[model samples]
Target: MAHTTERPVREREDASIGELLSAVTSDAQKLFRQEIELAKAEVREEATKAGKAAGMYGGAGFAGYMTALFASLAIVFALANVMDWGWAALIVTAVWAVAALVLYMMGRSRMREVSPKPERTVQTLKEDAEWARHPTR
Candidate 1:
């Protein structure tokens, strides 16, 4: 026997106002849940970006510290042999200061790239509001 793929039509015309309202409510709830899920996903993605930015900052901090500690000591001692110890120390300090500034700027740049707002979620929420207002469209 061949089965027809055609499905029965919903007799919305015969449906009571209560049933129609119930359907609208159910649809609205489902739509809300979907929107929330979308928002959560978007937020999670943004948070990951933020986390990466934070990691960059942390790495920069650690690198800056290590550079100051080891490089400063070794370079200062090597320069001390070539020049007065005080001059060598001052020159090493200046170099390390510049290096630290560069690292800080890099970390700041990475932080600037991180956006806490979920842009897609906000846009979709606005669209959802518009659709809720005029669902016929």
Candidate 2:
């Protein structure tokens, strides 16, 4: 006669495929949150770089505008001195002024194109806040 031992098999709920997939998705979400937090500094740095680039572009445009204004004035003065014709100089100066105004407006519109609003980042932050308020199980 041999002694026999009885043991009950353990039933693991997480052994099913669905349970495993859910566990993986939950862990992924947590990891995504942590990654987002880690990337905040990088995002801030990139934003600063973008802002600096925009400012440089703006300054370059303003400089070009002022240069055009002064050049037009210089042309008027030169024409007046050399040609000894006040009306011709005045007419040329007025044309230059109008051209400069048009160019300046165009430059302003171009600058507006690169302006940053941070709308996407703001929306992401809002979504993250909402998730934090009501996290998944």
Candidate 3:
């Protein structure tokens, strides 16, 4: 005869209702904790993206200020002398303007990528709510 580990149907059915409820409660608590952890991870990732976007904006602002400063100096020097130092200063100003534009574009792109809401967590929580409503499914 083969050895068997299965409990008899009568013995299985004898499990107390309190025991079953306790097991369900324990599992629910574990699931809740896991969901919380997932949400935190998602939020952290989004926050990091937002921080990068903000930094890019700061860099763009600095570049814009430099562009303005250089352009003013270029204009003053050009009025003083139209040929040598003036042209050089104007070239430098143009370079700063280009840098400022590039930085602004990069910051805009990064800002677009950032999302304040945690999308994945929202979707999962919605699913969890549905499951809570119809757990047997």
Candidate 4:
């Protein structure tokens, strides 16, 4: 019969509570970093989407502006013969401007809310780094 040397006591003797806790914390920090990386990628993707949306909105706004310009010109020409509705062109231009402003503000506000995950991920990683530097254990 051959006896195998299984030294479980040596393994337990070398690992202190502090070391174990540190290892766990280190692993947690690594996980947090991975999450942060994922968040950063997500932010990039969202930024690209926002950029494309902004571009489309810009194109649409330009088209709307051109349409409004032409329509106002036509209204002015049609109203030139009638003094009762000469201010209709000005009203049309004003309404178009207000509508464009509202759309732009709404788009800007929505884009602002898109990248919060990256900021939260960064905050979590910083907190994990701080904990690693001065662990309670």
Q: TM-scores for all candidates?
A: 0.84, 0.43, 0.69, 0.56
Query: Rank order by lDDT, top first?
Result: 1, 3, 4, 2
What are the Cα lDDT values of the candidates?
0.80, 0.62, 0.78, 0.71
Q: Lowest-scoring 10 consecutive residues by lDDT in candidate 4?
A: 4-13
Off by over 4 Å in 1: 1-10
Estimate the TM-score for candidate 4. Answer: 0.56
lDDT of 3 by residue, 1-137 (tens): 99854443356576677766666677679888988898889889989998998898897897689767866685757655656776666676677778888988888898898877778878988998899899889
Tens digits of per-residue lDDT for model 1 on 1-137?
99953322265667677777777787779888988898888888878877877777787788778988899899999998889999998998888878777777876887787677778878888998998899779
Where model 3 places Cα greater than 4 Å from the true spot, the runs are 1-12, 70-80, 83-102
| RMSD vs true structure, all candidates | 3.6, 10.5, 5.7, 6.4
Clashing pairs in 3: none
- Return whichever of 3 and 4 wins on TM-score: 3
Top-scoring candidate (lDDT)? 1
Over 4 Å off, model 2: 1-84
Count of residue pairs whose backbone atoms collide, per candidate: 0, 0, 0, 0
Best by TM-score: 1
Model 4, runs deviating above 4 Å: 1-36, 45-49, 56-60, 84-88, 114-117
| C-alpha positional error of residue 49 in candidate 1 after TM-score superposition, expressed in Å | 1.3
lDDT of 4 at 64: 68
- Tally clashes: model 3: 0
Tally clashing residue pairs in candidate 1.
0
